[model samples]
Structures are given as C-alpha cells and as structure tokens.
Target: MFRSLCTTALLVPLLIVSTTASANPEVDRMFAEQDANRDGVIDQAQARAEATRVFRALDVNRDDERVIAELDPQIASGSPGGDGFPPDIHVVLRQATMQLRDVDGDGRITRAELQQAFVDGLLKADHDGDGKITRAKLIRMHQGVVSPAR
Candidate 1:
C-alpha cells in the first residue's frame, strides 16, 4: 500500500507535466503538417517527407546541407508575421530536428539524416502500440509519458 501511494504520487506530476508541455498550438500545427494524407496521424513516410521539406527550407544555400548559422535565423525570427512558430515552441522542434538530422554530429544536417530523423520521430510519437501516432499520442510524447515506438 505504501509503495502504491508513492508510485501514484510520482506519476501524477508526470502526467500533468506531459499534458501541459504539449499544449501549444504552434507545436500542434507543426506536427499536424506531417500528416500528409490528413488522416490525423503521422506515419514513417510522412515524417520523412516533412523532414525533407524542413531540410530544404533551412538549406538556404542549396548546398544539400545545413549549418547552425543557416538554421539559427529561422528560430531567431520568432515565427515572425505568424509565418512560423513562436520562439518557445520553435526552439524545441528545431533542436529535435537538428539532433535527428545531424548524423555525423559534425554540426551539419544532411538529407539522409533528415529523412532518418523523421522516421525516428514517428516511432517516438506512436503511443498505444498502434503503429501510428494520433494527436493525443503526439501530446503524450511531448509530455514524456511514452517511449518511442520500436
């Protein structure tokens, strides 16, 4: 009984944190964009496509690669004119995107790495073991409630 109480105490905060952390409209928009078919879920292929789109957008020089300088401006813009996400939300997504796409850890994002990162993200968001991620699952992931899909 004591152990159960302690476990419940620990889990309650986590549940609250998870839900609150994911309650951003901009973040929701970004994830929703990945649902290419508009079926309300993001699959691996869709993730790959979105990642590719982001990679291209950030690769301003069109050198087929990205550096911190290239990606920084977009984040710094703070969703200027509502064309992007606010700083708070954009920062997280940008960091995650870079982490996933920078395979060599050399501070550069490549096309191949970008593709893989989205696939990784898809797996991470697919809670309920459903092989697909709904908005709720994405929110749960943001809250840190579930581990990525296998």
Candidate 2:
C-alpha cells in the first residue's frame, strides 16, 4: 500500500500538471495536454507551463496561492475523468500532495512552489538523475523494476 501510494501520489500531480502552450493548435492538441511534443519526457519548460496552468486552476479565487480549503473540494469531488481520486483515497492524496507542494508548511501553495514541485517530480521520474526524462531511460528503469536480471 505504501509503494502504491508513493507511485500514484507522484503520478496524480504529474497528470494534473499537463498542458500545452505552443503554436499550431492542432499539433499541440494532438499531444497529451501537458506534453507539447507528444514525447514521454516533460522538460523544464513544459513542467513550468503545466504547473502554472494547474496552479491557476486550483487557485479558484484569482488569488495567487492555494489553501487547503480550495484543495479539499477538488479532492473530494472525485468526478469520473476529472481531477479527483477515489473517495477512499482523497484524504491521503490531499495530504501527500499538500505536504510535497506546500514547501513552506505555511498552509498555502504559491505558483513558484507548485512549479518547483512539478520540476522536482520530473526528476523523480527521470530515475537516472540525468536532468532529462528520456523515453529509453524510463523504459530501462521500468524493465529493471519489473524484472531485475540475475
């Protein structure tokens, strides 16, 4: 359960932090909303853009920061195909996401803090400390996790 929580906790925020801001609306549209290049890797620019977008969505009051009150509802809603977790998972998800993103323990999240969270998450996914989320590297990492060679 702990491992599941760790992986999904990281993945959920990563999913929420996906969008596009490039020219060629159709082409950008073709990619994952957060992956402007349709590649599995999310570089720093993409991470920042997506983090800013997600932060804006979470702010809800046009204020520059996110508080627990704003986050609770979104986590509780659990609408299918929306930004929510299962009812049973919301509490943990909220707690983990908050703990990671808050960065200051001041009970609020600024845009920069959220952006840094996203960038940091990308590094976690990188798995090789290359400062790059390359597809080949991720595949190798996944394979090692799935079936370690003797």
Candidate 3:
C-alpha cells in the first residue's frame, strides 16, 4: 500500500506538468485574428498599431500615455466594450513598452525593441524548451485555467 501511494503521488504531478505544458488557444486565435494582413507573422508594426488603437480607446483622457495602474483595471475588466480587447493584448503591449524603454533611455520606442520584446516573451512562455507552446500551456501558466493536480 505504501509503494502504491507513493507511485500515485508521483504520477499526479507528472500528469499536471504534462497538461500545463501547452499553448493557449484563445490567445493564439486572438493573434491570428489581429494579424489581419495574414503575413504569416504578427510584426511589430501590427502590434504597435493594435496597441495604439487600444490605448486610445482606453485612455479616456487622451493623454497619449497609459500608466500600469490606469490600464490594469481596464485590462482586468476586459476594457472599452468589456470585450474590447484580448487580455493578453494588454500584456504584450506592456511588455513591448518595457523592452523599448530598457533598450533606449530616450523614452522613445523602436521596431527593434518591439521585436525583441516579442521574442523574449515567446522564449519565456516556452518554459519546457519545446520551441513552441500550445494553447493549453499558455492558459495554464497565465491564469491557472487548467485542472489542479490530484
């Protein structure tokens, strides 16, 4: 009985890890949908354009700047029309801005910075070094939307 219990316990975590190591379909779909030009990749220009649109819509004050505190609630509540933007969109935009800021102290953003940000994000999210993250892994990692280990 002791040996059996130990085996079960070990197996449980393995199952959980396996399940969590996948990408998020909703996120994937959002990316695809937004890549309207369908260039087989969502380039920095596309990302920035989308971000600008979202920022403008949410800024309310039209100050051309968005602070994390001001953005977080709108992001959490789904923004604008409540279904106004994908949650990950906000994350991606914020990450891009941070990367740009880090690379250049001038407070100006560049395409290279945005590209690096996206690449870095992909690398971080691909936790298992599998070169790709399925929808399930993304959801599991970000929101704990997956089932818990037994």
Candidate 4:
C-alpha cells in the first residue's frame, strides 16, 4: 500500500533536492507543499501521513492494490517540467518500489513492506538526529555539505 508511496516520498524529494541550488528555491517550494504545519521541517509523523496520502491517491482501483497501470493517468496528464507528477518519476517509482519493497520477491509490495520501506527511508534521510528532515538539510546532504551521522 505504502511501499510505492515511501519510495516516491524518498526519491521525489531527494531528486528534487539534488537539483536545487544552495539557496534551493525548489526545496522551499517542496517543503511548503509537504510541511503541512509550515513548521520548516517534515517530521516522521508528517512523512508517514504524506506517504499514506500518496498511496491512497495512487490506488486508483480502490482494491488496496497498486500496479504500474495506476500511474498511467498521472504520467499522461503531466507536462514537461511542470510542478506535477511526471512520467519519468513514475517510471523510477515503479522500479524502485519493486526493488525495495518486494521483500519476498513475489513481484508485489505488501502492506508490511510498505511500512518498513517508509521507516527505512525516513531513517536514512534524517541525518540531523532531530527526528525531522528539513529542505535545507536535504539540499545540503545532496550537495555534500552534510554527511549522515555515524
């Protein structure tokens, strides 16, 4: 359910953060969008909530299942370089979700795997020991200005 969502949450934000400048206007926009409380950081609870929301949105069939076809609409409706879900992102999302969340390797992501993936992704990205990930922190991590805690 949330495996793809977790992968998307990690990849999309990291990919966007990687392309941002030190000032990172893009990061600011992304933070604004995801940081529901306008608190300047995305905590684990917020990340989980977002991951769930993203999962629900992509579950087009409403069967508690997610397949590659479910992403077609979002991909088809996306514009080049627009601030919306794009085709390439979905492609990567599909592959990454399969790779990371298919724990039994049965070619499907189960609910347990989704929850684990979200926790793993959060732990990997939360480098500040603050239990939160801020846009500035992400940009700095990508820019090699900040290293993960040992």
Using TM-score as the measure, the top candidate is 1
Q: Cα lDDT for residue 70, model 1?
A: 63
140 Cα displacement, candidate 1 (Å): 1.4
lDDT of 2: 0.58
Using TM-score as the yardstick, the better of models 2 and 3 is: 2
- 84: Cα error in model 3, Å: 16
TM-score of each: 0.64, 0.62, 0.39, 0.63
Q: How high is the CA lDDT of each candidate model?
A: 0.60, 0.58, 0.43, 0.58
Q: Which sections of candidate 1 miss by over 4 Å?
A: 1-24, 79-100
How much is the lDDT of residue 15 in candidate 3?
30
**Candidate 3 C-alpha error for residue 70, in Å:** 1.5
Top of the candidates by lDDT: 1
- Clash count per candidate: 2, 3, 8, 0
Off by over 4 Å in 3: 1-23, 78-150
> Which candidate, 1 or 4, has the higher TM-score?
1
Candidate 2 residue-wise lDDT, 21-111, digit = tens? 2322322331254576766665778877877776766566888998766667555444345556765787786777789889999998899
Candidate 2, residue 65: lDDT:
90
| Model 4: colliding residue pairs | none
The superposed Cα distance between candidate 4 and the true structure at residue 124, in angstroms, equals 3.3
Candidate 1, residue 67: how far the Cα is off, in Å: 1.6
